[model samples]
Target: MTGSIQRVALITGASRGLGRSSALKLAENGVDVVLTYKDNADAARTTTTEIKALGRQAVALRLDMADTGSFAAFAAQLKSTLAGTWQRDRFDYLVNNAGTGAQVPFAETTEAQFDQLAAVHLKGTFFLTQALLPLIADGGRIVNTSSGLARFSLPGYAAYAAMKGGIEVLTRYMARELAPRGIRVNTIAPGAIETDFGGGLVRDNAQVNAHIADATALGRVGLPDDVGGAVAALLSDDNQWITGQRIEVSGGMML
Candidate 1:
């Protein structure tokens, strides 16, 4: 096992939003990071620079979660990166945080939309994790991103939330299967936040934001910090005993 000071994490979709925040939070705690971005190389570079400024090693790579065919190549590239950069064979943590949002009502949701959600949120996560398993050290950690919509009903989010629900179930299965290797797998189901996800509905629309705030016990919509901090804490060694659980960082929504 790598020493705590040398621990590294691979966070997907980390160019911005929760992933970016999580990467920074981890770096704040001395964890090196390799982050992935879908399209924005500039944003990814900025994240790496910030991590480097924090005195932690950082690398940014491109990854499209919806494309499973590219996972093998990504995994290969990751292996080379680990050797060339960190001189290590495996990383200590994996944050499967890359994702897209869908808001079509169940009745209006098309099969294409459903498939895209499944590909990005479920299939891609499953296979990418599988492909990267050999490079994840024993006693490592995995955090799969979920959504509060999976636990509570929210119209127009049926398809999106369903995929997250599947992820929650998958987390448990991964925890069970990977137990012998000492890998802990868990899910983080975040409440609506003010990110660019889902066309920024919750962030841009005052009525929607207010409605969410009223429903939440915290009386405010969540921010990237709300979730990124929780995820950072969860992946810390202090919470090693926790696995196969769904930790919702929703400020007590629907309670």
Candidate 2:
């Protein structure tokens, strides 16, 4: 077992949004980070710099969440990178956070759109985790990003929410299977967060934002830190005894 005194976490989609915030939060909590970006090199480098500024080791790698065929190669690259960068062969945490969101009215949702979502949210996560399972430490954490929409169906998001729902169920299976090794898995379903998701829907549409806010007991939409902090908590040692569960981090939304 390759164990570092300070653990490591690999957060995908870390160039921006919740991923970026989660990288910083995890680094602040003393976890070295391996971050991945899909198509934003400069943004990824900026995040690396920020993580280094926090006095933690950080590496930014390009990872296409839709590329299921390349996952085996990615796992190999990840192993080499982990050995070279951190002198460790296994990482202690994995955050399956790379995903896309769209609001196409179901009646017009295209096959390409559905396939894209499936690739990123379902197949990519499933295979990547499977490929990397050998490199995960005992008592490790796996955090999947689900969405509040899975619980409260909004028009135009049926497929998107459905895949997230799949991930939520997948989390349970992973937790159950990995329990013998002491690995914990859970999902974080965030509410209406103000990210670049869906062309800035929450930031631009006051009515839509307010509707989500009114639906949430917190009386406001979520920021990236809201989800990031929740993820950090789940990854922390303080979160022992919590797994195989879908945590609703939407601040009492729609209940």
The C-alpha lDDT values of all candidates are 0.94, 0.91
- Screening candidate 1 with a backbone cut-off below 3 angstroms (N, C-alpha, C), the clashing residue pairs are none
Q: Candidate 1, residue 184: CA error in Å?
A: 0.6
Per-model tally of clashing residue pairs: 0, 0
TM, every model:
0.98, 0.97
Model 1: lowest-lDDT 10 consecutive positions: 1-10
Write candidate 2's Cα lDDT for 67-156 as tens digits. 888888888999999999888799999999999988999999999999999999998899989989999998899999999999998899
How displaced is residue 133 in candidate 1, in Å?
0.6
Candidate 1: tens digits of C-alpha lDDT, residues 123-228: 9999999999999999999999999999999889999999999999999999999999999999999998999888889999999999999999989999998898
Model 1, global lDDT = 0.94
Q: Where is model 2 more than 4 Å wrong at Cα? A: 1-4
